[model samples]
Target: MFNLENLFGKSTRGRRLKSADRVSGALPFITAGETDQGISAFIGNDVKVFSANTTTIDMFGSAKYRNFKYGGDDHIAVVHTNKLPKYASVFVTSAIHKSSYNGQFNYGRNFYAKDADALDISLPVKDGKPDYEIMETIISAIHKLVIKDVVLYVEKKKKELNKLTENANAVKC
Candidate 1:
């Protein structure tokens, strides 16, 4: 049987379960005009740990929202829990807010339990046991790098779009 104590490095109930209490600084943001999609750095509902494998990579929200029949109405909203566990992935490259500007940043995964579970999580074992922290760090770094690259790409594209628009306006003038 898989025990939380062995996997999480802690045995307390709080450490093993996601408390019902609301997390501070966790504001809900909506994604619209698209299918329900989201990415979460946490795997289980207990505590959201920031890691590539642990993160949710699945589509979520109402299916109707994704279709244009409803005038492309309805949006998917993501709630960011501030109290992410210490083991949570720390994105040193770019904060979530900075990278997710205008929803251009893509985590390359759908934020959903089913999809998250489908990920191939390889835990690095040194002697005979897998190193949880090491694995978490590695995944976090991957996510950070990916998000950073995305941000840069989006910024570049936006600049190009702006330049073209400006040139077009200038031509008209």
Candidate 2:
């Protein structure tokens, strides 16, 4: 177990950007919402862009992994997991979610960068340190399993659709 800040480079809160002030464009504007990975809109406004491979914890303590550059509202805390490998960062994001998103932080007690810094998280350890290699391997294996399941489902759907097409043809004949 370790302080969340020690496991990463830095953690900071995002600046406030209002919906009405946003200009429409291609940059993702992340907010404190669970849907669409917390993206509220896309804008062209010049805002501080967070790096890829980072994690964002909302004021409500919902954590999300960000694989693309985005701008965030003040209600979000940016965790710089960009230094870690992609898979490892993903693992860290899950740990953050498990640690913080439990109805502990809400409207009255919102989560922030300081909250993230003080949060404790547990990771697989080896040689008295976090086993990032193991984390990467585990996440990679899970990704493979998920992909395999998706492919199998698509194949089954295709077969069923083909059977339906054949039945329709027989009815026409």
Candidate 3:
């Protein structure tokens, strides 16, 4: 186990952006909400743009993986996972979520960058170092399984729909 700051890199808090000042555009504006990966809106305002392959922890302690550049509000803490590979970063994001999103942080006690810095999480280690290779492999295998499940579900749904259509046609004949 290691502290989040040491495991990844520097952690920072985002600046505040009011909804009234937001202008619609292409840049994602991250907030404290869990829906849509915490994206409140897309805006053209010139806010500090965080890099890709990072993780954002909301004030409520919900962590989400970000694979695209985005701007965030003060209610979000940005974890610098850009140095790690995408799959490794994803693994770290999950670790962060499991460690932090426990209903401890709330409106009265919001999560922040300092909290993220102090957060401890367990990772796959090899020779006293995080095993990025293992993290990557694990995420890749999980991705394949998810895709396989989706494909099977689609096939089953298609067969059911075809049967319904055939029965309806026979009844109409």
TM-score of each: 0.34, 0.97, 0.97
| Candidate 2: tens digits of C-alpha lDDT, residues 60-147 | 9999999999999899999999989999999999999999999989899999999999989889999999999999999999999999
Stretches of candidate 1 above 4 Å error?
Answer: 1-122
Per residue, candidate 3 scores C-alpha lDDT tens digits across 8-72 of 67699779989999989999999998688789999999999999999999999999999999999
Clashes of 1: 9
Q: Candidate 2 — which residues are off by over 4 angstroms?
A: none
**What's the alpha carbon RMSD for model 1?**
13.8
**After superposition, which runs of candidate 3 have C-alpha atoms over 4 Å from their true positions?**
none
lDDT of each: 0.33, 0.93, 0.94
Give the lowest summed-lDDT range of ten residues in model 2.
5-14
User: Once model 2 is optimally superposed onto the true structure by TM-score, how far is the C-alpha of residue 158 displaced, in angstroms?
Assistant: 0.6
Q: What lDDT score is found at residue 44 in candidate 2?
A: 97
